[model samples]
Target: MPNSEFSGCRWAVVLLVMAAASPSWAAPIEQSDTPLPADCDGLKKLSLPLEDAPPASMASSLKGCSSEDLYFGIGVPKDPVRARQCAYVERQDPDNGWPNLFAGTGMLMTIYANGIGAPRNFDIAMKFACELGGAPAEEEGWLAHLQKLKNENWQGQDFSPCDDITSGAAMGFCEAHGAKLASAARKAKLADITAHWPSAERKAFAALEKAKNTYAAAVADNEVDMSGTARGALSIAAREAEDEQFLATLEKVISGNLPSVSPPDLAETDNKLNALYSKIQKKKDTSDWGTVTKAGIKKTERTWLIYRDAFVSFAKRNFPSVAPESLKRVLTEDRIKSLENFGN
Candidate 1:
């Protein structure tokens, strides 16, 4: 891979400032090597995982990968060197079923694109992205665009696909792409767990999934204010969390490890929620309410109540022994926390 940092300087700025007096190519600026082929052969030339490594599916490519964790600083200090090393190790692994090759290469793309631990190299980043592949026409079109730039001998640094992500909508789209990758892993695991279920059970699970999705959408739209640029990203993040929680709750149910609660416990939680709701409604004129108004709070509470009932109904279908009251209590407690944290 190209190791030159000479291209990292503000060469474009310098040229622009002197453009009126000097010719377009007057400066002896170094040109990047011709764009690499957007193919596995070009990917291998980067010397990352291997030269002969086979292409892998993009599904579940980012789930539970060390490179992802290191690069994103999830539960550990971010270390770009280790991140790159882990990515290389993952890609070279013989097991294609696990999220390995694409995960590694994808992380490398992010690392180079963002200059996490090295000079930003869009050339290397583009090469990594091409290896991921996509619908044939779209993939070819993207490569063609890049090739055009190379052929024209564009003096400016090559652009990464992520270069123009300046707004919430753009970031949200980026997160949506990542969510699709992560969702693949969750779907795979769910399939494995439910492979032996009866038709009735499968049908019930489908209903539960539909209910969960409805509730998730409600939560994203109602719980989070949509007035800011990050609203898109924030709303997506909320829905993603709901997806994860759905899978996790199912796993717990299958394992018979779901917590149990009694009627009294449910009543107490409901009482607390009611008290908090009344207080907030009466204090709507206070500055402590922040951006949320009394009407909005009422609407959110109504939405939450519907979600709580749907959750309980779903839980009862899959795990009859599990108390519906327990689910209600837990959901109410979650609402309580959300209310308590309003001004904090």
Candidate 2:
């Protein structure tokens, strides 16, 4: 990533001057890697009487093996059984003083729903998504949406064929196809419309748009399986690879390397960041948090922002920490999770 790209982040004139004084790449690893504990088989062999164990006992049993950390943009790459067990423990003790178990459940479910660490399964995803009574109950119009995929497929990308929405694999495969197709089409449309966009974000828009297409092109050959986590990983890898261009460009600009710094584009992204921050606030305002206070939301978000900005340079320098969009995505997601599960 370039130094000039850093300008897109939140900044005041003074900070900009200071940042310019010593522009450098920085990355922060969220958690230390640890050895994986008992797999599903090992977990089953535990003679600790799981079935009859009370919720507290179960929760106590999983201690020291429940950290939900992962790399910057990977979300929680949970151990399938550990994540499942995490949910089970939480479900058994939903009223724990610290609902972190439920938090772990939500993380695992997110991975399951998206097929991040394992093959995607709609039923399992829904099972996890609905754990907190926050997701919509099964209803009509749902299957209709999943079945709509039969009519679309990225123009020519061999989207996996699916005939039954009842199958989690089919539903997930179709949804992934539709979403990717829609994303590609949307980018094409944006490219055409950018000619009319205000000049400030025009160049930046073009860069990002091109970056996205480059990413798509890189993965164009392989058959994209939306029902599995590999495809998602590919997307992340491609995007991270391309975002480096932004940093590369930024680096030149910071050292007076580029012809001009284009304050307009910086303003544009800044506006977007602020808007997203406010959006989270609005979501918090309306969400029901049982006993958790809105102050928790504010405090957590602020801490996240601090942590996020601190590593901007390092992330730009490193290939995988996170891009700007990834940073916002994780933060927004973490905020929403907090709202949904207060103790999280």
Candidate 2 least-lDDT 10 residues: 12-21
Q: Which candidate is the best by lDDT?
A: 1
Where model 2 places Cα greater than 4 Å from the true spot, the runs are: 1-81, 87-105, 108-124, 135-250, 253-256, 260-344
lDDT (Cα, tens digit) per residue for candidate 2, span 215-253:
334332221222333344333333333344334443432
Top model number, TM-score: 1
How far is 21's C-alpha from truth in model 1 (Å)? 27
Candidate models: Cα lDDT each: 0.55, 0.35
* Alpha-carbon TM-score of each model against the true structure: 0.51, 0.24
lDDT of 2 at 153: 15
Regions of candidate 1 where Cα sits further than 4 Å from its true position: 1-170, 286-293
lDDT of 1 by residue, 1-344 (tens): 22211111110000011101110112222225765666645643443323212224432553345765576554467676667656655644444221122245545555655566545555655565565433345345445545555566544432443332332332443565456555756877888987898888888777767766777776676666555556656667767777887676667656767568788888888998888878877773545433446676677677667667766776687678777776677667767876774533
Question: How much does candidate 1 score in TM-score?
Answer: 0.51
- The TM-score that candidate 2 achieves is 0.24
Minimum summed lDDT over a 10-residue window in model 1 is located at 10-19
